[model samples]
Target: MEDINLTIQKGEFAAIVGPSGCGKSTILRMIAGLETPDTGEVLAEQEIIQRPSPDRMMIFQEHALYPWLTVEENVGFGLELKSVSKSERKTRVESVLKKVGLDGFQSYYPSQLSGGMRQLGLAV
Candidate 1:
């Protein structure tokens, strides 16, 4: 990896393009706090990233999945880990799913969904 500096402000879309395995994802992981730099800093606002948090979310190139969980369960998994109640989690998860164009496939498993739906599932 070479030294590079870039800033993406709030309400903006930023894409990194380069050859495969050229540390494109490495940069995102550092920003998302999934990986630490050997030296230097990764900050969200004024806070230094140290670990994964809801405030700093990441969805990788590969569709992230809990193989044993259903579509609904996978979408709601984050809130579940935070100990949110079932009713509220359900409500939020459903809303998010719908926003990502998954309006009626909640009960489907990952195996039953198409690649696009699986990607949509991960987005929710």
Candidate 2:
């Protein structure tokens, strides 16, 4: 995590390569706004990131979606944070869930879903 400098252009794909314990996840976490740097600031779209925003999302290696909420609820959560109207959120969530092939499982909780299904939920 020492003096790492990088710039990823819009629509570009990037990779962080290193051996174990090299703080690669740390860098991604900072970029995802889940962690704050000790000194330098993190910016996206020319704006300094001071805290977590709904605009910034990352699918963690683990199933990070709420187990208490159903699939539809989980997908709609993002739109809800943006102040999207209830009906619009419902429609968008339903569309995304269906797009991810989770249509019939909208009422299912995380514990009821398989590993692949859980990952799909994050993508919603």
Candidate 3:
């Protein structure tokens, strides 16, 4: 974590790679505002990130979905929180689930889905 500096272009597909316990998750959390740094700053889209932005989303490693909510509900939870209309939420949920190759599992609960399927819930 010494003097780390990174830059990503608009269309870049970048990833963080490191050994376990080597600060990979730390970096992500700091950028995502889930953790704070004693020094240095985390910026996104030219803005200093002081807190999590609604426009920026993080798919936690824990999946973080309510077990009682179905796949579609979990994926659309953010939109729901934003007070998006029911029809629009439904449309977006379906579209994102399909984008993640989960065309037929919208009705599935988190417990009923595989781990990878649960992870796809965050793609929305």
Runs off by more than 4 Å, candidate 1: 66-69, 77-92
Model 3 spans with C-alpha error above 4 angstroms: 6-21, 30-58
Give the alpha carbon lDDT tens digit for every residue of 11-70 in model 2.
998888999999998888888888999989888889987777866767778878988999
Task: Assess the local accuracy of residue 89 in candidate 2 as a C-alpha lDDT between 0 and 100.
Answer: 89
Q: For model 3, how does the per-residue alpha-carbon lDDT over 55-119 read when each residue is reduced to its tens digit?
A: 56667787788999988888888889999999999998888788779979989899998888877
lDDT of 3 at 6: 86
TM-score of each model, in listed order: 0.72, 0.68, 0.68
- Model 2 scores a TM of 0.68
lDDT of 1 by residue, 22-43 (tens): 9999998988788998888888
lDDT of 1 at 81: 94
Best by TM-score: 1
CA deviation > 4 Å runs, candidate 2:
65-70, 73-92, 95-101, 108-114
lDDT of each: 0.85, 0.86, 0.83
| Model 3 deviation from the true structure expressed as Cα RMSD, one decimal place | 3.2
